[model samples]
Target: MRSRSTLLDGRCTISRCLPLSLYRARTTRPLENHHGQTPVRKRLNSDMPASTVSSRHFYQNETLLDFVARSSRPVSLRQLAFFGMKLTNDKIIQSANFVRQELPTRMAHRIHDMQSLPYSIVRNNHISYVYELYYHSFNTIRRFPVIKTVDDNDRFCDVLRELLAHHTAVIPHLVMGVIECSDLIDSKRMDNFMESMLRSRISRRVFTEQHIALTDAFLKDPNFKPTEQVGQVFFQCSAADVVRQCDTLARSLTQSSHEGIPIPELVFEGDVNTKFACVASHLRYMVGEILRNTFEASAERYQAMGNPPAPVLVTIIDAPQHVTFRFSDRAGGIPPEIIPYLWSFVKGPRSMIRHHNFKQVPVLEAIVEELETFVAVARGQRKRISSLTSLTTRSPTLRLGMGLPMCKIYAEFWGGKIAVKSIEGFGCDVFLHISKLGNESRFVQMNNI
Candidate 1:
C-alpha cells in the first residue's frame, strides 16, 4: 500500500498513505505541501471494491458521469460514430440511429450528453482517440493467447464501456482536445493547399506574360518571323484563334523549367475535354500545383543546405478513362506528422519567403484565387458523384491541400468521384472522375476583381 491524497470537485485532501500502482511514483515526496496541503493527482488504478467508502466518495465527487447526467447536453455525429466503432457490433449503430430518431428525453440523457460537445472538436480529438483505442483493442484481441473463439469474450464491450466512462468523466477535456485537433487540421490543410494554388497561378501569370511579350516582339521586329519559328507553331493558328482556344482548351500549367527533370509513371484515363468541361485549365492548374509544391519543397531544402539542384521525376498516363500525373522529388520525403495536413491550405512548418518591397508577387492573393476556383466548383449545386463516368487517375496535384477536395468537388460537381492513396515515406497518388461531356469546353467568367 502507498500513501495518497483524496480529491473532490478538483480539490485534494491529505491523508495517510496507501499502496496503489498509480501512486507508487510519488512516495519519495512528502504528502504535505507548503501550506501543509496535499495535491492529489487523478488516480487510474485502485484495488478498492466498488462498495468501499472512499470509492463511493470518489465516484460521487470526482467523477464527471454525474455532472453529465444532470445537465442538458447535445450529441454529435462524430461521438456517435466513435461509440459505434467502439461498440460490440452493428447493433450499437442501429441503437444510436434509433435513439437519434427520437426526441430528447430523460431515458436518453446519454445521447443528449454526447450532443453537447462541439462537432469540430470531436473529429480532431475524440474521434481520433476512439479510433486509436479501437485499433489497439483490435490488435490485442487478435494477439491474445487465451482466446478460444471470436464470440467467446466480451472484450469489445468492456473496452467500449471504459471509453464511454472516460468521455463522461472528462467530457470537457475530451471535447477541448477534439476541437483543438479540428482547428489545427483545418488551418493547416487550408494554408498548404492555398500556397500550392498561388504558386500555380503565379506560374500561369508568368506564362501568360511571356506569351504576350513574344507576341509584341513578333509584331515589332522585322527579323522575328512567326512562320519560321523552330518549334511547332501550334501546328496551327492566328492570335484570335489562340485567344479563343485560351477561352476554351487553354491549359493553365506549372512545370519544371529544367528540361532534365524526369517525369514519373502516373496517368489517368477518360475523355478529358468531356468530363472536365471548360475546366481543363483549372484541372491542369490543380495538377501543376501538386507538382510545383513537391518540386519547390525539394528545391528549397537543397538551397537551404547548399546542395546542388536535385532533379524530380514526374510522369503522366492518359487514356480514355482519365488523365494522371505522378511527381517525385529528391527532397528526402514528407514527415509523418505533416502527412495528414499535407493537402491543407494552412501554412506549414516551412514558411514562405516574404519580400520587403510591394512589387513582388502577392502569394496570399494567388492562394485565395486558386482556392476560389475550388470553392466555386465545390459550391456548384448541380454536381453529384452519380453524374460521372467511372475512371481512375493518379497525380501529385491530387495531394495538394485543396487539390483532392477540389477534384472531389469538381468531379462531384458534374457527378463524378475521387480516391487517393499515399505512402508517407514514399509518395501519394490521387484519383478523380467526371462524367464525359463530349469535349465541350465549359467556362464560367470570374467576376471582375
Candidate 2:
C-alpha cells in the first residue's frame, strides 16, 4: 500500500517519489456466462480497457454530478424538434441525445460542472484543464473496441454519435472562451484568446475529419450500418438559387429597415453553368449574409447623402478546388480603425441590436418559411434517425454585428475563408470562398476568429 498524498485536485494515494509502477495501469477482468451459481471469469490482456473500456474513466469531480441532478441539465435529444434551438441539424441532435442517454451519471455530472463553469474561469488557463481531461475522454470514446454481440456493437455506434455531438459542442465552448477574453480588463489577455481561437479552429477542423474517417471505418460492418452520413458527400449545388435567395433576403430587409428604399441591384459574373459542387446550406447562409451587409450599408449611406444606392456587384469565380464570391457595396469604406475590430467578437455598448423577439427578424415571414422548407428538403439526404420537434424557426433576421462573424465561421467550417477590403472612402469588397471539396467530417467546424 502506498502512502496517500493531497493536492487541490483532490485525493490520490501515490507519493511523488514513488516508482512509475505505483502509477501503473490495471488489467481487465470480466465475468462471463455466470449462471447465478458459479461465474466464469476471464482476464483480458489489453492496455486500453482500464481507460477506454469503462464509461466512468473521465470523471474526477463529484460536485458536477450534483449540479446536473439539481438542474436536470442533460436535455433530452428528442426535445430539439422545436424550432429556435441553437442548431438546426437533426443528426447532431440525435448524437447529443445518445450521449446524454449513455453518459455515466458521474461523468455527466462532471460535464455539467464544466459546462456551468463561470466565464471567468473558462477564459483563463483553467479551462484548458477541462479540455485536456475531456480530450482524453473523447479519445477513449472514439477508440472504443467493437464487441461481437449486436447489443455491444450498437453501444459502440452510440459512442460515434456522441463524438459527433461533441464536435458540435466545440463552437459553444470557443464562443465562451472568446466572450470571456473580450470581457478582460483593458484587453490584457485578449490577444492570447484570439490566438487560441484560431488554433482551436484549425485543430478542430483536423480532428473532425479524422474522427469521421474513424467512425465510418468502424460502422462498415453489415450489422452496424448507420444511415446518417458518416462523412461528407458532394453534389451539384445551384449558385443561381443561392444568389436569388440572397437578393430577395437583402431587398426585403433593406425595404423594411430603410422605409421602402430601393434595394441595390446585384450583377452576377460567372460561368453560364452556375451549378457548383458544394454544400448548399453553407453557401446559402454565407451569400445571404454577404448580401445583407452590403445592402444595408449601401442603403444607409445613400439615405444619409440623399442619393440612390449604387448597384452592388456580385462576382463568382469558379475555381477547380473552390468557389469565390466577391460582393462590392457602395457604403463608403469602413473606418481604418474599425477594420481591425471587424473580426473580433467584442460587442461594445452599441454593438448588438436589441430585439425582444423573433418578430423583428430582418427578412419577410414568407421568405423565412421558404428557407425553412429548403432546409427540410435538404435534410433528407442524410438518413435522419430521430429528432425532437424543432423550435419554430425565427423569421430570418439580419442580426447586427453577428452577420460577418457568423458568416466567417460558416464559411471557414467547410475549409473556406472570407476577407473584406475597404477602399476607405468608397465601398467595401467582401470576398468569401466555398471549398468544392471539404472533409465531410468537419462540416460543423468553426474558426476561432
Candidate that would win on TM-score: 2
Candidate 1 residue lDDT tens string, 1-449: 32232222112221222223222222234354232322222222222222222222212222233333443233221222222222232433343222222212221232222222232322243333432332222222223233232232233223223322332212222223333343434454434333332332222222222222232343345254343221111211122222223222112221222234332222223222222222333344344445455554444455455455454444443345433434444555666765664444333442121111111211122121333243334346332211011111112133223344444434443334555555554445444433333321122111000
Q: After aligning candidate 1 to the native by TM-score, how far in Å is the CA of 397 from where it should be?
A: 18
Model 1 TM-score?
A: 0.28
TM-score per candidate, chains pooled: 0.28, 0.51
Off by over 4 Å in 2: 1-119, 123-234, 347-398, 438-449
Off by over 4 Å in 1: 1-277, 304-310, 343-408, 411-435, 438-449
| All models, RMSD in angstroms | 23.9, 13.6
Best candidate per lDDT, number?
A: 2
Give the distance in Å from residue 149's predicted Cα in candidate 2 to where it truly belongs. Answer: 9.9
Q: Quote the lDDT for 388 in model 1.
A: 13
